[model samples]
Target: MEIKLTDQLDQIYQDARTIRHHVFVEEQGIAETDEFDGTDSDAIHFVGYVNGEPVVTARTTVTKKGVHIQRVATEKAARHQAYAKQLLEYLLDQPMFEDAPMFYLGAQKTAIGFYQTLGFEKYGEPFEEVGIPHVNMRRTHSAADHHDR
Candidate 1:
């Protein structure tokens, strides 16, 4: 599967949102109010596609410190398929984010090691986010990491 990054109206945006809503709201049981907070408008979103069908979503926003990645989700049928990883890798390759000083997120505890293997390092003590345990993790931009991709 190939992942593509796009703006809000590419139809993939809706597909991405469907994955997010399912993963975060329905399956995870997060409240609709908390899950659908209005920040997507200003952020860049990505969707992973398999044979032209979107199946995963992830996004990032540039901040004063660096790029902040968030909202990674995969449709139930697409879990374990490396789709979110593809979305994240493509996101990191974008010109606006590729050379940022850092990329970071508050990752769910279950996925911490997954991000760690991808170069993110955990920093803070774990805390609850969306009623799930999460930890702050960051990946400092390194030429070697970029080269590997």
Candidate 2:
């Protein structure tokens, strides 16, 4: 699989849209407006392709506190293959986030274990966001956490 960073929407527009549609629209019934916030212009989008087919997508928004990961999804065929994990590792390795003191993401309740494996810890009580239960998670950066497989 290969991953690319693009500021231009043209490069990842289709894949990112499809992934989000599957996760937020079809599967989760999250409103279109909530899923497609007009923040793409300022976010760094990452798309991962396997065998030349886009299989995973995610984006990062730089905030005053840290980098916030959002829209993380994998094509159904790509699930259980570690594509999300790989995409996340690639994101963290980017120079833009390498020195950031914290990394944060709003994780679906069902997927919190996956994030914990990467060293993220839930911060507050779960709350409904767009009809799904989510909790804020944060991880302080450390050489060890980044180096782990």
Model-by-model lDDT, in order? 0.82, 0.85
Worst 10 residues of 2 by lDDT: 140-149
Cα lDDT of model 2 overall? 0.85
lDDT of 2 at 35: 91
TM-score against truth, every candidate: 0.91, 0.92
- Native-to-model Cα distance after best TM-score fit, residue 87 in candidate 1, in Å: 1.7
lDDT of 2 at 134: 92
Worst lDDT 10-window in candidate 1 = 140-149
Q: Model 2, range 3-23, lDDT digits (tens) per residue?
A: 987777875766788888887
Q: List model 1 lDDT by residue over 1-149, tens digit each.
A: 87766667567778878888889999999988887688877778888888988788887888987899888888888788777777777777777776689888999999998897778889979899878999999988784276478
